[model samples]
Structure formats: C-alpha cells, structure tokens
Target: MTSRRSFLKTSAVLGTGLLMAPNLYARNKKYIGVQLYTVRDAMAKDPVGTLAKVAKVGFNTVEGATYTGTQKFYGMDPEQFKQVLDDNGLKMPSGHYMLGDGMPNAKGTIANEWQKAVDDAAAVGMKYMVCAYLLDGERGSLDHYKETAHKLDLAGDICKKAGIQLCYHNHDFEFKQENGKFPYEILLNSTDKDLVKMEMDIYWIYKAKQDPIALFNQNPGRFPLWHVKDMDKTPKQMFTEVGNGVIPFKDIFKHAKKAGLEYFFNEQDICPGDPFNSITQSYSYIKKNLV
Candidate 1:
C-alpha cells in the first residue's frame, strides 16, 4: 500500500485537478471542516496558533473535540474561543461533549454538568453537541444501550431547548452484536428521531464491514455530520489521509443528500507527521474530488 505522503506526491504529479474532474459541489459551501482532535497535541499547546494554521489550510469550519472537564473550550472561555475562531476566519458549528460519569436518576433527570455543557455549547454558537463516545461501562447488553438511548433523548431535549441539536457519534463497537442485535440499531430505534441525530464516522462504518449508503437508505436524513477519514489499503488498515486509501469517498459523497449531510470534517486520529499536512492533503482531495 502506498504511504499517504507518497500517494499525495504521486497524485500531484498526475495533476490532481485533471484527474479528479466532475467534482460534486458541497451542498453547504462551508461544509469542509477539520475536527480539531486531529491536532489535539497542537491544540493543547496553542489553540490560537493551531486554528490559524487550520484556516491557512483552507478550512472554513471546525468541529471541536476538547470541551471536557475544563468547562471551557480548549483552555479558553466560550467567548474567547469564539473570538479565536473569528480571528482565523473559522466557525465551529459542532463540538464533541462527553456524557459525563453520572447517569440520570430513576426519575430520568441528568446531572447539572450535562445541562451546563448544553448551555456552554449554545453560548459558543454551536448548533450541534455530539455525544462523542461511550465508555466501556456504558456498553454491554442491548438494555444498556436502550438506557443510554434514553439518556441521549433527555440530553437532546435539553439541547433542543437551548436551540442546539444533540447527536451521537459512533465507533465500530456500536455495530458489534450482543444477543443477535446491534447496539447501533437499539440506539437508533430507541431514541426519538427528531431529538437525537447521528454523526457517522465513515471509516469506522467501513471497518465494521457496514455500508454507509445502506444505512442512509434505512435511516434517511438521520446523519447530518460525517467524519471523513480513509483506511490504508493494507490489511492492518491504519488511518490515512483521505483519497490516499481504498475508501471510495466519491461514491459516498454522491449520497450526501440522502444522508442529510450538513457538515463533514477530516479526522485522522493518527498521522505520520504534522497533522496539518494530513488535513491539507485531505482538504485538497475533497476540494478537487469529493467536494
């Protein structure tokens, strides 16, 4: 398999624009964003500088990944973070927030911190607050997933009241079967469609051997956000920059309308070098090919 860097070099030689013609325009002109988690280290060091680099790479929007514990976004207050984004010509329409340790009591009331998270998200002008992951203790049986779904609905209600939407971001584990049923299915069926939407990580969906288009067909308009990463062609299937791997993104982008895609972000969890380079390569490919 070609290394992502090498593939990018080769594509440049092939004349990227000429090779990737007939591109589909993005439904939302600012749909191309980068999930900041892709550069967590840099963000931790200097969020302002990192965001400037992100803007320089041609990203107009960003999805934040660091809003846990700090009660602030990337070590700054909500207003400060918003100003940083504005200075860099960027907007954050969505952000990842962990459903904290406490579960809803028997009365189905969530913790105060969760409500605070919703409030903070709204203050930052974010339209979506994504339940980014589920801990090991949070998963096991179908009933556990159903319970989580109930919590998601409660959280979604809070977010809806705050004028923000709540979404769930899935990993491959959600697709694993427990007692002949996928937890993903439980979450989808158990949650109220209007309250809880989904953010599809296309790479993980492929890793789980599932078809994104099939899911879109089954649950039309449920996925409004997507994490666009590619899997290396090798059996190990390591994460690679978009368009440098075997995943057929062009085919996937063709179904954006059916999937109700409002925003898509490039997110490579692990990169070979500077994360910005990985994002830039993905951005170039998306602009010239997938849109």
Candidate 2:
C-alpha cells in the first residue's frame, strides 16, 4: 500500500515516455470553480467533454484529483492539460498531491513532493498549492501537525518565490478537542502567519459543531480559500445542494474580507444524484447567496 505521504517512490512504473508540456494560465472572474472530485465518474469517462459541461455550468476554476494508479492530471501532460483547461475557459486552482517519493521508508520529505507540486502547478499557472487531506497514521500527532506546519512554512516560501501561496485544507478531525482545546487552535497558533494559510472546508466545520461565523470572528484574515460545500438536512448527514444545507453562507460571506477569503470552490464529497445537477445547484446558491 502507498503511504499518503509518498508519491515519487512507488516502484510503480511510469511506463509511458511522457513529459507534460507547459501551458499558460487563464485568468477570468466568471470562472467560479469546482473541485474535480465532485465529478470523478464524469472525468474518468470523458475529461474533455465533462470539463466543457463544468464551464457551461458557469465554473471557470478547477482543482484536480489523483487515484492510486494514476499520478498525472487527467492523463494529459501538464502543457496539454493546461491547454484543455484553458480551452474550456478554466484554470487549475489547486491539486491534491500525494506526498513523498512514492516508497515506504523513503528518506525523503513531504515537502520535497510539494516542491515538485508547486513546479507543476506553476507550469500550468496555478497560484495556490494546498495539502488536500490528512490521513490517519500519516497525520503525525499534534507535534506532527506542528512539524507539518514547519514543512508548510518552507513550502509557502517556495510558493512565494513562484508567485503562489500554500494552504492547508481541513476536515472534521482538526476540530477535535485536545486536552480541552481544539487542535486547530494549536495549528493556527503554531504556524507562521505569513508563511501558512488555510482553505476552510465549511461543511467539515459544521460537522464538528463549529460555527463559520465564530471561526471568522476568532481568526480573521487567516483563511483565503474555501471549499464551499453543504450538508444534508436529513439524519443521514449526506451532502446536499448549497442553499438547502444548514450552513449560513450568506452570513459567512458577509465577513469574507475579514476572513481573508480570496477564492472559493464548490465541492461535495458525495452527491445524492447527478453530479452535474448537483454542481449547477451549488453554483446557483453561491452566486445568489454568497458571492
């Protein structure tokens, strides 16, 4: 099994003689984005056609995903891939990077993987690099979080050099109480303010019984990116359309400046129905209620 911390070390062969070509970045305001994970099935089947639909749905920004066997983006070289995104009126906002040398016990770093990540991202004109999610064992303890923060500071430094920034995305676990205080607090307190930033996953905060307003009040200007997702109203805790959920995004967006929100993307871990319809509804909610 590959450790979430490793990406380059998997004895897994890159059988194709392929090197990604670089393409210029596209800049446009109408392109509110969607994380590709939302349309995994669609992308897997027809990346070009599916991306065209995403643009028609009114999203111009996009994040990427990686599966166990495939490490490349949508199977296109970075250049070809960027051209595809730009042709569809979209740009890569961020990408989920599998950290490390792709090997167990590889004496490399999670940061090293990120260095390459930023390079690839820069090649395609991305402005932010984020650690998408933390897995169980790979999540080193609170001390490990601090250690991760150190690495992020360095990564942020690298990003800054390339005209990009580094951010950490969260799940419900970061809100867990540690000795009566939330670990998220420690992560926020310990990381260098200028070097590290956050991409708030609003749905996860709600799952942890935390309020986005209160979070904004406590740490203003710390969050710049957001995963604007919603939860179901039913007892099952499923994902639903944005406005239908319990989160008060209207109230949250009111304080966007103070919260340091610069960019946001619509994401749903699981949609109850057609993924396209789900995103269309999500986009409508954001444009009307939040943005």
Candidate 3:
C-alpha cells in the first residue's frame, strides 16, 4: 500500500496547476480555531485528510504543534503545508515552537536555527510563534524560568523582525511555587512586554487553582493567545469537550478583550473517543456560544 506521506509527495510533484481563491477562508470569517495537536494521531497518519475534516467540522483556523523535529509542518515543507492549508480553506496564524534545551538535537527551535524557523513561519503567514512547553529537564528552580524568559525575549526579537510575536504557553507547572515564587509570575515579569507575551492555557490555569479573569485583570493586554480546553468535574479532572466541563468558558471569554486575545485554539490533550468528534463538539459549542 502506498503510504500517506508517499501519496502526498507524489501529489505535490504533480501540481494541479490551480490557484486558490483570494482570501477564501478570510472572507468566510471562521471564528473557531483548533490546535492541530488535538488530532495528533490522525495528523501523523494523514495531515491532509485530518485538516479537511477539521475544516468540515467548522474550524476555519488552526494552530500548529510540530515543526522543530522535522522542520516541517506535518511532513510537508512550509510551502507545501501552506498550500495544503489554502486547499482546505484554513488559516494558520500561530504555531508552537520549543526552546530546544530538552531536545538538544532538535532543529528549527528557539535555541537552534530560529531565524529559519521564523522565516518559515512568515512564509506560512503566521503572526505568532509560541514556546510550547518546558520539558522536565528544562524546568528546575525559579532561576530556570528567569533564564527561559530571557531566552523568550531573545527569540522574540528575532520573531519581531519577521513580523511575528513570540509567546509562552503555560502548563500547570508554571503555577507551582518554587522558593515561594510562582514561576509563571517570574516569566511575566522577566520578559520584555512587547517581545514576550503569554498564551494562557485555560485548562492548565484552572487546574493550577488560579483564576483566568484575575490573571487577565492583573496583566491586561499581555496575553494575545489562548489554549481553550475543558476539565471534567470528576475527581481526576480528565479532559472533556468544551462546554461539557466545569471551566466556566463563558465567564472566561467575557474577559478576552482584557486578555488581548487575538486567536484561541481548541486543544484537548486527551479525549474520550475520536479526537475529531471531540473537536467537532467543541467547535459547535464555541461557535454557538463563546465565539
């Protein structure tokens, strides 16, 4: 059987000689966006097909989650991936990158060939590049976060030159206090406001026992991106589709203006059934209620 990657390569080689309609997805004004990582398995198997399904489920925008390892977007080079997005009428305004300390061998990360990464991001029309997460080895003391913040500012400078904003996406660990100081606060304070911004993960913040509204009020306009997910009400607090959990999304969304949110992506790290079904449900709820 022809592998999906092989098929895509062949398809790319045989150009259709077609042009995408100008501003096709932009004209549609699709408000709902999803993180491509939500369907990681499917993306690994067939990114093109998965993206088509994502569009069919009513998501007009997507945030990419992989680039460093292969220096490609879902096995396709930047140009090819951009064409795939255009073919599906989807826009990718943001993508997740890494600091590279954890993956010392990884390329195209903030610590490696970051300029090339920024350039590729620009080619794909991305406005923001996010520091996805800090691996366990990368996080230790408050000083580590301070160092990470400095790195973010440095990377941000490069991204700024390419018309991209650099952001930090937090997990629950950032909220944990190290020597009585919250690493999250250290990050917010240590980085340049214009260069380094926040991409608040709603589920993680809530899980950490912090209030999103309070964070927005405290640092108004410092956040430009958000990872939207929900936590079930069970004791374990497993992941659930948006509006099917106790995250109080309506209340959190009310402060989007204060948060300076430009784009938000639905990202459920785990799901109960088909990831597509979970995202579809989230998209429907967000479209009907949250926007």
Candidate 4:
C-alpha cells in the first residue's frame, strides 16, 4: 500500500489541477486549524496534497511549518503556495517561525533573522508569527526570557505595521518554577500583552500539570491562539487524538470566549500508526463533541 503521504501527493495535485472549488466547513464554531508539523512527512513528499487533505478534513485555518529550505509555504514560492490555499478553500492565519534564529550576515544575531520571518509572514497575509520551540540552552533563564520578551515586543511592532501579531508557543519548560513563580508567569507579566501574545499549546500545559482555565483567568485575553492537543492516559504524556486523553478539553473550551481564542490547531508530535487517521479521529471528535 502506498503511504498516505504519497497518496495525498498524487491525489492533491490532480484534484487541485481540476480546479475544483474549495469545500466549505463549519467555520465559526469549529475554527479548527492544523499545525503543519503534524503533517510534515506528508508535506515534504507532496505539499499540495498534504494541504488538500488537511482542507478536506474540515480545517479552515492552518499554522505553518517551513516547507523545506525555501523558508516559504509548502515548498512553492509565495504566489504558487497562496494559490494552493485559495484553490483548496483554506486559510493560513498564523505560522510557526524559527524565532530569534535564521538571520543572515549577523554572525549569530537572532533579531535580524526574526525580522525576516515577520516580513514573510506579513507577505503571506498571516495575522500571526509564532515562536514555535526552544532548544536546550536557547530557552535561557528567566532573565533571558525577559530579554526574549523584549525581542518579542520588537517583532510584534514589525508585525503591527503589517497588521500582524507575534506570539509564543510553549512546551513544558515554561512551567518550570523559579523564585516561587512559573517562568510562564514571568513571560506573561513582563511582555506587553498588546504586542507579544501567546499561542498556548494545551497539551504541554497539561503535561506540565498546569490548569489551562486558570492560566486564562490569570492572564485574560493574552492568548489568541491554542494548540488544542490532548495527552494520553499513561504517565508518558504522549500526544493523543483530541478528547481521547485525560485532558478536559471541553471544560477548557468552555472558557474560550474569555481565553480570547482566535484560532485553534490540532497537533500530534508523533502518530501511533497513520498520522492522517489520528488527525481524522481528532477532527471528528472536535466537530461532533467539542465544536
């Protein structure tokens, strides 16, 4: 059997070439997005198809990963890639950027690099450019996070000109306590809410044993994006299909209006078998139960 990745490649290009009108999904209440990383393997093989399948699954929005070295959308140049989304009736309102990295000629300066990312995101009509991850030492200390907060403020300014916002996505590390408080708290308190925003990954917050609703309560309207993934039942905290894990996703979403959730994406860092199946199951669960 051909891998679903391969199938999507062949099917996507052909389907798109046929100039089929994009399918409509439950836009308002659902508002589900896909973290492109969840389909990275598929996208690497066939960018167009992977995206088409994502659209087919009823996702209205996407948060992107870099498509190969192009540092652009889905391995195609800007126009071609935008056409793909248009042809598929999809929208990418946000993107995961290599924040504080990827600058040219600075000999290890991250500011210029993040500037380029903001420029690209703006060109693509993305409202948000999100700092996706942090390496081992790159996370830095609370003070370093303070510095990052400042950089984020600058990035947010650049995006502001283009009518975009910059946000930070978190893993478990931000929850690490320091001086009787969470670094996440430090980041929240230090940053300008109007400028530097958050894309809270719900799974990671749960994994770190924090309350998503409480986070929302403490910092109301700071979170504009959410990675609505769930955690497995076991101690390992593996990413499971949404609503299939111990995380009380429904309860969390009950506060969505107050949480200021503008976009939500489904992401699983690793899939148990076929990643697409995991996605479909997650989509179905969200559509039927949560959305």
TM-score of each model, paired residue for residue:
0.87, 0.83, 0.89, 0.85
lDDT of each: 0.81, 0.70, 0.84, 0.74
Can you write out model 2's per-residue Cα lDDT over 184-222, one digit (the tens) per residue? 665666666566677899999888777776565455566
RMSD of each: 10.0, 11.1, 13.2, 12.7
Tell me the deviation in Å of residue 167 in model 2: 0.3
Clashes of each: 0, 11, 0, 1
Compared to the true structure, candidate 4 yields what TM-score? 0.85
Model 3, 1-291: lDDT tens digits are: 433233223323111211122121121224579999999999999999999999999888999988988899999989999999999999999999988998889998999999999999999999999999889999988888888889999999999999999999999987676565677777877888779888999999889887788776656666778899999989999889999999999988887776677788999999989998899899889998986
Name the top TM-score candidate. Answer: 3
Model 4 residue runs over 4 Å out of place are: 1-27, 67-69, 101-110
Best-to-worst order by lDDT is 3, 1, 4, 2
Q: Candidate 1 vs candidate 2: which has greater TM-score?
A: 1
Q: In candidate 4, how many Å is residue 162 off?
A: 0.8
| Candidate 2 vs candidate 3, lDDT winner | 3
TM-score, model 2 to reference: 0.83
Model 2 is weakest, by summed lDDT over 10 consecutive residues, at 15-24
**Which model scores highest in lDDT?**
3
